[model samples]
Structure formats: structure tokens, C-alpha cells
Target: EAGVVQSPRYKIIEKKQPVAFWCNPISGHNTLYWYRQNLGQGPELLIRYENEEAVDDSQLPKDRFSAERLKGVDSTLKIQPAELGDSAVYLCASSQLGAGGYNEQFFGPGTRLTVL
Candidate 1:
């Protein structure tokens, strides 16, 4: 268990049909994030990387949503056709200095996707 590494923690599709999510962080923590917790609402910041250079996705919403981090270590987020409000809880946090840096982000246990 590294720190920020998401997977099939939970996922159930149906709506538009198209889902993909993956992440890996916590090695050298060069700053990485990909939040979207809508249940109780809290984690927002849809994207933010520095190692592979995503800079700051600025809320991220390019049409149907999409993300990547080729050489940034590991990162992948996509939602081609999934709708139904996109469900929620897809967190993937990692920090070592970002958005006022100081390292305090360590959250995973997410991916509870359920769109029907």
C-alpha cells in the first residue's frame, strides 16, 4: 500500500457506458491529485500534477472528462460516456508540495462508481 493508488475499489457502470480510472503515487511525491467526492462533498480539485506536468487541470471537465500522466509516474482518469451524474468518490491524492505545498494528502479507498 503506497499512498495514492486507486483501482477497481468499486465500479458499476450502465449509463453512457465507459469508465476508466487508475493512479499511483507516493514514491517521491512530486504532487498529484484527482478528486471528485460528491457524496458528502469535499474533494473537488479534479486534477493537479507536477511531475509529468499537468500543472493544474483547472477543475477539469473537457467535455466528458479525461486525464493522464504518461511519464509523471502513474495516472489515468477517463469517463468517455458515463453520465448519471458520474456518481462520486474517485479520489486519488498525493502531495509533497502543491497548492501551497507541505505534503498532507494521503487518501485512496475510493472508486465507488455506480452509475445506472
Candidate 2:
């Protein structure tokens, strides 16, 4: 009955350092997503997972970013050698896939990453 859960609500690091974020979706939810939002911009989908499969990840930066949803319940997002441009809020969301692919997402309090 819980919504999405994220750890380390805020993070600060020097440029070129690595950073990671964690997320736990709501119980019984089959879809999970990770998004990044720059200041004054809407969230951009970084990756989306249907259970254990990553269904969409075109926006994710493969060279320095990676993500995984192990066992289809929890997920992690990592950015290696973080850049100053990577400073933003990382949001995790989940929803139950319903009939005809209809679902309403629930979001967690995003992790604010600051690259110094």
C-alpha cells in the first residue's frame, strides 16, 4: 500500500564522482520508471521497466549511466563520473498496468543531486 520509496533524498558530490540512487516501487505494481528533471523543466523519462525487463531506455546515457531492476521489485540508477550538468532531481514512479495498458503513476519524493 506504500507509494514509491527512495533513499538519500539529497546528495552532493564533486564533479566526476559517481552517484547512485535507489527506488522501491509500490507492492503489486508491475511498471517502474526513473526520470530526471532539470531546473524549470519537466521530468524526462530516463528508463522504464515492466517487471524485470527494461522496456524503454532511449533517454538514458549509456556511457556513464546504468540502471537495473532486480527481482522486478526494486531498482537502482547509477551515474559514474557525474558531471555538473547532471545536477538535477531524480524521480522514481510506479503504476499497476491495468486493462488496455491504463495506469496511473505514483511518484516518490525525488532525490536532489547536486554536482559541485
Q: Which is the leading candidate under TM-score?
A: 2
Global CA lDDT of candidate 1, please? 0.85
Model 2: CA > 4 A from native: 98-101
Q: Write the per-residue lDDT of candidate 2 for residues 14-100, one digit (tens) a residue.
A: 999999999999999989999999999999999999999898899999999999999999999999999999999999999986421
lDDT of 1 by residue, 16-88 (tens): 9889989888888877889898987787888888888888887888899999888887888999899999899
Instruction: Name the regions of candidate 1 deviating beyond 4 angstroms.
Output: 1-29, 44-67, 73-76, 85-94, 97-102, 105-116
Question: Which candidate's lDDT is highest?
Answer: 2
| Estimated TM-score for each candidate | 0.32, 0.95
Poorest stretch of ten by lDDT in candidate 1: 94-103
